[model samples]
Target: MKVNIVGAGVAGLSLAWQLVQQGVEVEMFERGTRVGEKACSWFAGGMLAPWCEAENAEPVVLEYGKESLAWWQNALGEGFVDAKGTLVFAQQRDKKELKRFARRTQAYEVVGHDVISSLEPDLASQYQEALFFKDEAHLDPRKALIRLTEVVQALGVKINFEQEIEPEDLLPEKVVDCRGYNAAKTVQSLRPVKGEMLLVKTNEISLSRPVRLLHPRIPLYVVPRDDQHFMIGATMIENGHGHQFSVRSMLELLGSAYALHSSFAEAEIIEMGVDLRPAFIDNLPRVERDNNIWRINGLYRHGYLLAPYMAKLAADSIFSDTHEIEKLADFKIKEDRV
Candidate 1:
């Protein structure tokens, strides 16, 4: 059996990886010149913290997101995923916010400044207490995308870059649409959620894991990368396609970073990026099958956290002789045409 995957984003690449492993021929078409260019996953924080995400997301997200952790580690091999876990903190004035977050999420241990310092010394003096999700992990989205692309290609999947193929154009050809926000026209329920991120480098501070600074307004998360660099993000503005970051957004993001640590104020700005993430009304991912064309979309901000599991469901549905929609009801499998 053979399949044509549209869009080489995390979702499409993940599907290609799974299908090829099952002895299926796979060909991928990406409009971007290379991987992670046109995809919203490029700007992701790459946190695999399902428990942390459960604060705002549904239970299904946490369930499948946990399963995807092993899938990513196995697919990328050793040393790619940082399994140090996630630290969530809030300001003293916003202590209620921390309580609220803890109330909504589970699988975390509340710790004081001593433990916080032990986990990330840079944060010892900044936060009095925090929630630690020990089972969580993170990876660099850019590195993961490039590595996954290489792995799939090595597995005999042909990837055609700079090639644009609409899902409808590949009708009756076993197409999997992972076009994200570009598929808004066909997937009417899909909406664009604009997310903005900034990359900064500072030698003054160090972090071992992703840290979330909870706020009533725009919550912030800073993921550590190699070379004293940190990815600061967390803006979920609704309905916009502009690629440039707004002044207010920049201020809030930077201010939140400063709140995390004073060193960020002097950190060198490495990059600023903005992109629209596709999301459904419930802000969860879905695997929708319409005849021979299957769509793996509505990943929202959970692209890296959920794509692997979503792709598994898509691959299973495709290879199954009988409809597996009922079996995957929790993943929100939709049989209606999109």
Candidate 2:
């Protein structure tokens, strides 16, 4: 069957790859110059730490997204990603919050200042304690997206560049829309959570995996990339689509960076960006079928962390009814699997 996908984001591209691998013909249409760029997954921290996410995410997020980091690394290969684990820290004042976080999550060990210092010399003595989720992992989202694009294109999938596709253009064969906020115009009540981010360059601090700093007012995360650069984010504003980072937001980000490690004070700010994460009030992704069109949206912040799992289920969605993936079904699902 020939399937035409409307968006080239992770959901669309990944679904395309999975379908074509199943001996189906696929074509992707992108309104932008390329794929993945339209979605926040492109700039994502790509951390698959369900434990860390448990700090704020719903219970289902941890249970479902836990299989993501390793699944993608194994399928996409090691060169396209990294599974180095994540370290979550906080100031002494936020120690109570950290304890609460640990109490709610699993698969982590407490790290004291000494062990934390040993792991991140640049962050030595910076934080009193941190929670280390060893089973969790992170990757370079930009590189991973590019690699996924290249691989899918090489697999006989045709991509039309800068082509705008309307709903009437969709066909009856398994079409999943992954257009992110663009779908907002189609799905009513869809809200955009504005996330502002900053990139700074400073080899003064090097981190192998993603790190999160718990703050009372604003929570922040720092994702290190190649060439001593780090993608720091973000201020979660409830309304608006302004791409420019506000003065106050930037100051808060930089201050958090400094609080995490003193070396970041000397880092040069490279880039600032803002985008809306399409979401419902619940913040969990929803897959809806309109006629033959399967619309997947509301990824919120889990686009990178959940896209692989989403794609796999999307594939199954095309061929069969999904297994719901609830934790209560775990035992029956596993037992019935073999």
Candidate 3:
């Protein structure tokens, strides 16, 4: 069957790639000139730390996101994933939150100042204690999306760059909407959660995994990229995508870095971006059919974390002959997870 998809971000590309792999002729439409160019995933920290996300995410998020490790390892090649896990810390006064977080999560060893300093020598004397999620992992988001686009193209997908079309007309055998937050105005209950991020060049410090700095108001994290670069992010504000950064956000983000490691004081700021993550109020992903179209949105901050399984479910729905007659029922998309 011939399949067509909208959007060129990770979700759109992932969907197209999965369909193509199943021997379907897939064509994709992108209003943007390149893949993964303007999407939120481009600036994400790419931490596959499902356990750490347990602090704010649903249990299913971890269950679904854990599949990311093996999927990414297969997609990006072995040794591409940084399996050093996540380092979570709280202020000396907020030690109770740290203990609570540890209690709620799994696969971690409580580390004292000595072990913490030994793990990240640069963090010596900075944090008194930490909970290490030893089973987590992270990846390079920009590289991963680019590689995903390349993989799809190599698999014979016809990616129509700089092209935009409405699904109201010219429907193919199957239509999938991977437009992320843009679907909010169309779908019910899906809201856009604004996320702000920063990329900095730190010749002075090199940390091995992602570090989650606990803040009473604005929780933050730092994801290590290639070379001396690191992606420090994510201020989750309940607003729309406003490119302008708020002064309070900068202060909080920078302050979190300082608390994580003092060497960040000397790092040169590289890039700052803000985008809206499409998410439901429940913060879980959903797949539903509308007339002739299948909508897959509300990835929230879990795009890289959930797209593989989502795409597979979508592809299976499209190929299911029985579902062609019924929308949701035909969508037997059993969360047939990764």
Candidate 4:
């Protein structure tokens, strides 16, 4: 059966790849000229730390996110998913905040000043206590998106850029909408939560993995990219303002980076970005099959962490013709055999 997928974001691209791999012809449409710009995944820190996310996310996040590490490795190959783990720390005043975070999460080892020095030598002087989640990983979202797109295209899936497709425009065996926040018109439960991030470059300090600096307010996460670049983000505002970055947010994010290491104060600010993430009422992803269109969305902050598994589920339902897809909206949806 031929499939029509709208939106070339991580969810859409991942789903297209899954369908095509099962010998189904896939055609994808994106309103943007390229795959990376329009989607919220572009601004993501790409941290796959399910244990850390469990502090605020539901149990399902950890359940599916644990699978994403291997899934992404298979999709994008080695060097794509960085397994350097995640280091979470706090300032002297925010020690309680760190302890509170540790109590809520799992798969982490409490590290003192000496251990922190051994793990990330640059951070040891600043933080006396930290929690190290050794199994956590991260990726460069842009690179992953591009690599996945290349693989899907090589598999003979057709992706048309600058094409905004509507349900009525396609006559395919199945139509899947992975438009993220743009699907709000069709999915009433979808809401856009604005997230802001900063990209900075510095050569003075080196870090191999993602780091979360805990605070009572304005917590920050920094994910190290190739070379001297690092991505710092933590803000999640309710309103869907996508025009520009807020001054207050900029100050806080940069301040958190400085708090991580004094060298960040001199790091060059390469870019500031803001994007709206699609989320459902429960802040969990759902696959609702209505008539011929299947809407997969509400990824929230777990796009990279959950899209692969969601894609597998969508593909299984499409091929089996037994599952309604909508009935699988429950958080307890089992892992797809694929």
Q: Find the 10 residues in a row with the least total lDDT in model 3.
A: 323-332
Per residue, candidate 1 scores C-alpha lDDT tens digits across 1-338 of 98999999999999999999899999999999999989998999999999999887877778789998899999999889999999999999999999999999999999998899899998898788999999999999999999999999999999999998788887767889999999999999999999999999999999999999999997999999999999999788999778989999999999999998898989999999999999998887888888898889999989998899888889988999335553333444432322
lDDT string, candidate 4, 1-338, tens digits: 89999899989999988888789999899999997878888999999989999999877789889999998998888778989889998888888998899888999999899988888899887878889999999999999999999999999999999998785567445888989988888788788889999998999898988999888888999999988999999689985666588889999999888887899988998989899999988888887676677778999999998898889888888788745564323555444332
TM-score of 4: 0.95
Residues 1-338, candidate 2, lDDT per residue (tens digit)? Answer: 77778888777777787787788888888888876656676766667778788777776678778877666776577676666678888888788878877888888889887878777766765776888888887777778778878888888989988888775567656566878888888888689898888889996878888888988788889988899999998788886686777889988999998888888999998988778888887787776666567776788888876666667666666666453422322433565676
lDDT of 3 by residue, 57-132 (tens): 7667787788878878877676668888888988887788887888888878888888888777777567878898
| Weakest lDDT window of 10 consecutive positions for candidate 4 | 329-338
- Order of candidate numbers by TM-score, starting with the best: 1, 4, 3, 2
- Model 1: weakest 10-residue lDDT segment is 329-338
* Whole-model lDDT per candidate: 0.90, 0.77, 0.79, 0.87
Error of 3 at 253 (Å): 0.5
Pairs of residues clashing in candidate 4? none
The runs of at least 3 residues in candidate 2 whose Cα sits more than 4 Å from the true structure, single-residue gaps closed, are 172-174, 321-338
Q: Which residue pairs of candidate 3 clash?
A: 278-298, 323-330
Pairs that collide, model 1: none
TM-score between model 1 and native:
0.95
> How close is every model to the real structure, measured as TM-score?
0.95, 0.91, 0.91, 0.95
Candidate 3, position 18, lDDT: 75
TM-score-better candidate, 2 vs 4? 4
